[model samples]
Target: MPGYKNPDLEYLDQQGNVVGYGEVKTVGDADQSAFNKQLAKAVKQLRVREDVEGKMDVNEIFIQVPDLVDAREVRGWFRSYQKGRLHHGSDLEKISGYHVRVYTGSGSKLADVDLGVDADGGHYDESTHTYYSSNGYSY
Candidate 1:
């Protein structure tokens, strides 16, 4: 726990269980370095929560960016980047067991784009700007 990083945002449910963790980055253009750094930090935080603390209840991990392109680039980097187990790439992939979400928005506004699955195993519907899971639940 001494060396573990902390995510920008940690969402918890009513029961105080960690439901998700998020990292927010507002940057100019698609800067891979900044994106990777923030993402890596979030992933490491999640790793400590999951692997070290045994918090298996966390359901999702997300990265929020002001630019959609940056979000896409971050997603791409997560999919392709390679690193050791305790490093960025692998830590990110590990947290993705609960699925990774990349939402584009700032402040407290509803996200313009939600790029991941919802709680019920369904993908976000871009057209409706809504999340519809396989169990017919919409969020």
Candidate 2:
């Protein structure tokens, strides 16, 4: 649409269908506010677009930030935002459908940070090879 915002990256499936949308923040020192704005905009755009909303499998949203930033702090900020949004009656579908991934230098490989909201309303944050649960437990 003419007034709709565009995502930084669109992930398509083999059938040329949009499966996910991504917003990338290239500034290594960018703060959580920037990321929050980018993600909120991307989600709003994706939710309003008919083509994207029609696809049931198109639920994943990616927030790509530079690897130089602190992943732990970024995840913390995202979780906090999510909690606040959920408490304020935001759509659950949008609040819990994001993944934060970091890219190192110019490599194609993605360092995935599995930040997911579980069925029990708990947060999952994974960095590198370690995993942390929302209940102040890490293994």
Candidate 3:
């Protein structure tokens, strides 16, 4: 669908403008790198929200520290940067918003996979163990 964005949670103001939004993530604190990866996903979602809706003022990230990782070593660098699609600061501005096409080495057919939107869509290769949603579908 065109111009369609589904966010887990959305925030709006009195004028009904999209103010803030973010997705909830429950991650094990055993590894700092794993936690960082989860944080990166949230960052991208924050940009999508701002691009589709609006910007926010305050910035914050809350999470529990896993005893296995160094408490001070954990990076709290969750500053929000808006990466728009149709609006300002959108990286897709020059790409013409959904008009761009991808090509592999063959260049014969369009690529069907969009790995970026994995928070919703999930895929798994029998040869590999890249499981996104264990509850939705898994083998």
**TM-score of every model versus the real structure:** 0.49, 0.57, 0.39
Give the higher-TM-score candidate: 1 or 3.
1
1-139 per-residue lDDT for model 1 (tens digits): 5646675677889998776665555534455566556655655666676666565554444555554453234434543433333353334334445544555555322222222222325565577656544644343
Q: Could you give candidate 2's per-residue lDDT for residues 1-139 as a string of tens digits?
A: 6536666677899999777666565534456777667656655666666353664344445555655555455555556657656778874555454555544345433334333453223444454533355534332
Better of 2 and 3 by lDDT: 2
Worst 10 residues of 3 by lDDT: 95-104
Can you write out model 3's per-residue Cα lDDT over 1-139, one digit (the tens) per residue?
3324565566678898666554554446545455556654655555555566555542223334344433123311111111222235445222211111112223322222122222224444445433333224321
Measured on C-alpha atoms, candidate 1 has an lDDT of: 0.49
* Model 2 alpha-carbon drift over 4 Å, by segment: 1-28, 50-53, 104-129, 133-139
C-alpha root-mean-square deviation, each candidate: 6.7, 5.3, 17.2
lDDT of 3 at 99: 13
Better of 1 and 2 by TM-score: 2
Better of 2 and 3 by TM-score: 2
Clashing pairs in 1: none
In angstroms, the error of model 3 at 83 is 19
Between candidates 1 and 2, name the one with more favorable lDDT. Answer: 2
Off by over 4 Å in 1: 5-29, 68-75, 82-93, 106-139
